[model samples]
Structure formats: C-alpha cells, structure tokens
Target: MTPRTTKPQMSVKDFEELARRAPEFVRLEFINGKVQVKPVPDGNHGEIVMWLIRRCMQQRPELSLYPEQGLKVEAYRKGRARPDGCLAPEENFVGQGEWAEPGGVLMTVEVTSRDADTDQRDRVEKPDGYAASGIPVYLLIDRDACSVTVHAEPEGGSYRSITTRPFGAVVELPDPVGITLETQKLKDYAD
Candidate 1:
C-alpha cells in the first residue's frame, strides 16, 4: 500500500512514540514530515527479497541483507525509514537502538509495493531522503515499472548519479557496493 498521510503532522518524537506502540503487524515510517504506514509484503515481495538474499550472499559473503531495518534518515537524523533491505557488514547494527544511525550502511533497498503513491514515495521522496542521510546507495526494485534503479553519489542532499535498468538487464550497484546483479531472474518475480 502507498503510505497515506495522517492529518496534522506530528513531530518526530511523537511519531517515534506512536510507532513504538504500533502493533507488530503494522510497519511505520517517518518521511518528509509525515507518518507513513508501510505496506505488508506479499508473496511476490517475499520471493524478490529471497532472491536478493541469495545473490548478495553469493557475491559478498562478508555482508548481510537485513530486512526491515529501521534507519535514521534525512537531515539531522530526523526521518526514520525501514528499508526493505539494508546491506552492511555482518553485525553492523549489533548494539544499536530501535532507530539506528545510517553511518555504516553501505546500501538500502526498497521493492516497490502495489500502491498508488509508490512513484511519489519510492521514486522521488525516498532517494532524496536517503541521499540527504548520506547512505551510499539507494536501490529501488520497481515492480510496477519492471525495472531497477541505482541511486548513488549523494552530494548536497541528492544523488549525483541515477541509473535505471529493465528487469532483464544487468544492473551494477557501483562502488562501495560493487555488486553486479543479473536481473534476468527478477523477471520471474515481477508484478
């Protein structure tokens, strides 16, 4: 589901409190000064994540793909996003609290959900937020577009480079990540 904006924007503190009290089944995020309820993953989403897990493990065994990792994003660690996958060295967040700083995160991934505002949230706002937070890369698996986008080289609150490839193409997640994905397999899980 595309995140629906709640009425009367709340402070990050209040949002964090509410998110803590939220039910286990619901996922929450704070972005662009609005509270967003994340969509539940469907079977396709699960398969895609699993596929990524296998690929990442095969290529970079030193790192682990952490699912739904709560990250402090945007300026001044004001925004919180639970990326679909956070790629970092093993045990990168061992002692962190609920919302961990994005200091050592190599990359953050998001697989698009079947929702109305995905383009706005994922394609536009998310990259800006992640870039501002200085996360090295933001990988967006756009199910609706049947494509994958790699956002890298964050400078002045935006990514200097943006590359998008079709599902069947070879996608390279540039330096720091240095993983080339054979996205042909992703075609099988396309929504």
Candidate 2:
C-alpha cells in the first residue's frame, strides 16, 4: 500500500510572516495556506494594467488606484492575494498594515500571466477567494482565452453573478466604478 502524506497548512500568522520576509520585488499570494510566487509582469501585462489604472483614475479621481497591492481575503482561511490593480478610497489604506483587508476594496483586477498556476489563480481561485472575503468586484483579464470576466455580488463563498466579454468588446463595470472599459487595445502576449 502506498503511504499517505499531507502538507501542513500554514496559519494566517505564518503566512504574514512569510510575506514580511519575502523580497519586495516579488509578488506573493497565500491561497488556502499555500503560497504562490509570481514573476514580475511583462511589458504587455504592464501596459494593460496601466491602461486600466488610467481609465479608472479618469472615472473616479477621488479614489486611489494601487498596482500590485496585497489583499487579505477571508477571516478563517485568510487567503492573501495581490491583484494587478486595486481601486479603493485612500483612507482604507492610509494607516493599514502592508496587507489590506478586503472590506474597503472597491475592485481588484487580475491579468493572466504566462505561468499556468498564476492563470489558474486569476481564473479560478481568486474570484472565489475575493468573493468569500466580501470584496465587491473581481475582474479577470484572461490572455489565454482572450476574454474578460467580471465577478460580483459575492455570496456563500462565491460570486452570485459573472459577466464575460471578448478582447475587443467593452466591459461595463458595476457601481463604484460604473465605467465601460475599452479592451480593444489589450493585445494578447502571443499577438
């Protein structure tokens, strides 16, 4: 018979400690006690993220847009995620710790990367994690699939609604943003 083995799940404190020890140049996420390290984004990824930042800023000058901000999702499991872009009022993060809890976050955007694990997190785990944490909106731009998915109305550990649009189509964001994002210029890395 084969021996059974199990990986020890990290406590929230342990995850926080790990993040604190990690180098500033790297991006890290704690999902269900497992740590995921992401590489620095490529030019295409940065371009898309910057475009979103500009558009969001234009729409709501009062709110602040932060790139690659670590977010704490969920109280029990405590999933820690860093989105490509985070939109929130400045007050929410003024005196907070390095990681901000999801309560004050208005929206989070994730652009798919070359890594399969990173893509999976953006497509699958992050939406559920953010929703479970009560974050209002989770936006995923999947380069592999050439689509943008908006997940909102979090409830019961999942998003109650999801909307998807192709690369060239405009995606209409909900309240707090209420802006139609132009995706025509967002090119896939393979392009």
Q: Count the backbone clashes (under 3 Å) in each candidate.
A: 0, 0
For candidate 1, lDDT tens digit of each residue in 1-191? 22324543888889999999999999999987888888889999989999998899999999999999899998778789999999999999999988999988999999999878677778887888899989999999999989999999999888999999999999999989999999998898886
- TM-score of each candidate structure, all chains considered together: 0.94, 0.89
Which parts of model 1 are misplaced by more than 4 Å? 1-8
Model 1 Cα shift for residue 183 (angstroms): 0.6
For every candidate structure, what is the RMSD over all alpha carbons to the true structure, in angstroms? 3.2, 4.1
Candidate 1: worst 10 consecutive residues by lDDT? 1-10
- Scored by TM-score, the top model is 1
- lDDT of model 1, residue 50: 90
Give the alpha-carbon lDDT of every model: 0.89, 0.78
